[model samples]
Target: MKLAELEVNGVSWSPTKASLPVLHPTTFTVGAGKVLGVVGPNGAGKSTLLRLLYRFQKPQTGYVRVGGQDIWDMPARDAALCIAAVLQEQASAFGLTVREIVRLGRTPHRSHYATSGARDEQVVEHVLGFLNLHPLADRDFGTLSGGERQRVMVARALAQEPQVLVLDEPTNHLDVRHQLEVVSLVQNLGLTIVVSLHDLNLAARVCDDVLILKDGHPQGFGPPQTLLTDSLVSDTFHVDARREQLAPSGASHFSFSLPN
Candidate 1:
């Protein structure tokens, strides 16, 4: 899939006309093939911002553009062809096998009366292998572990051949190894990625740039190394954060304590 730039220009949203906007006018850009990490405390509107990017929800005040074209102006199917999302909530597979579930990603590319063609099968097979799910391709999706299921969801998204990928809390319930694996996979995808993550260290490690949110307002936006300072973390997350560099890799890491 060709990489595309993602732009959010002063986008804002609210649940109803009378409700206060859950997301204030927010703006950011993810360059072609770059990974942008969204980080914030719960209810800070990270997911709200992501929903706007993937066209799951329309903004009240601004435009979400992909490759310089407004997504709201495109057909839903056309938008799906360019952008794919792996949401935080896993979908029920209804006893479907892994391959069957992954095959569903091809829906946006097919006509209503069209059957699964050779190219669709090829793409599904390739995505399964790319995510190393070949061993479980025949297994019922509901029978897999949390990490395995997460990988399957990712494979399904990959099968879409999307130019931009949006993942909402992709590593939510996984163990340490699986979390690292997911982070590594995302970093190597070579697609424009917008991922919302609660783990600040993972965001710092995998993201080219980070967008910090607090109470539905943008707190900061820039490279993580320069933007995720101790003071910022403390104020936004309400934690005492200490930054440390690992011994051999010299990567930035954080340790947090409850505020005194």
Candidate 2:
């Protein structure tokens, strides 16, 4: 697979509210085989940044590039072949089965009929296995639990065989176990990934690097251990938190408490 560095060059986007900006001249790069977590509280422009990465929204200025080529310059189908996204606002596949939902990832590789060939079916099966989804493959997607649906969405993205996977809040609406499972699954994917997460502890464990954003401005960017400091976390998230290195892994973790 041709995984390339994902780069955002001084991207700044202004929302319809004339005086506000969702992203402010923000720039960062996600190296190949790295997981970069965009972490911040709600309305921190994390989602907006993901949208920019996947070409759902254009920046008022600057650009997003993968493998040194501007994404905007590539054709839609060409871009899809390189980047696959699991977004929060996607339409629900009410009547589709899990296998069929995963098969949608092959759409770009097919004609208008969107039918899958043998190889496509194999790819779907592989994805289903990768996510340990064979048991639920025939179930109606709408009937599955939230975590199951999220896994199906991820499997659909994997069906694309993308070099870079982009996800927005993949763990939302899931229990603690499901959240950890989802993050662990993404960590093992071995692709350049850029995910937006609200949970800093998960960000610290899963992200190779963390980009902090607050009120539409770039706050800081580095290895989570280095940048997710007490000061930065408190200032950006407004929560008093403590950082500690885990016993065996040396991975950092945070404990938060609200100020009285």
Q: Which candidate is the best by lDDT?
A: 1
Which digits, one per residue and each the tens of the lDDT, describe model 1 over residues 1-260? Answer: 79999988999999998999999999999999999999999999999998998998999998999999999899999999999999989979999999999999999999986989999999999999888899999999999988899899989999999999999999998999988889889988899999999999989989999999999999999999999999999999999999999999999899999999
lDDT of 1 at 194: 95
Query: Candidate 1, overall lDDT?
Result: 0.94
TM-score of each: 0.98, 0.95
Off by over 4 Å in 2: 16-18
RMSD vs true structure, all candidates: 1.0, 1.6
The 0-to-1 C-alpha lDDT of every candidate, in the order given, reads: 0.94, 0.89
For candidate 2, write residues 1-260 as lDDT tens digits: 56789988899887674767878999888998899999998998998888888888988889999989898899899889889999876587879999989999999888778668999999999999999999999998889988888888989998888888999999988899889789888888899999999899889889999999999999999998788889999999898988988889877778999977
Q: How badly does each model clash, as a count of residue pairs?
A: 0, 0
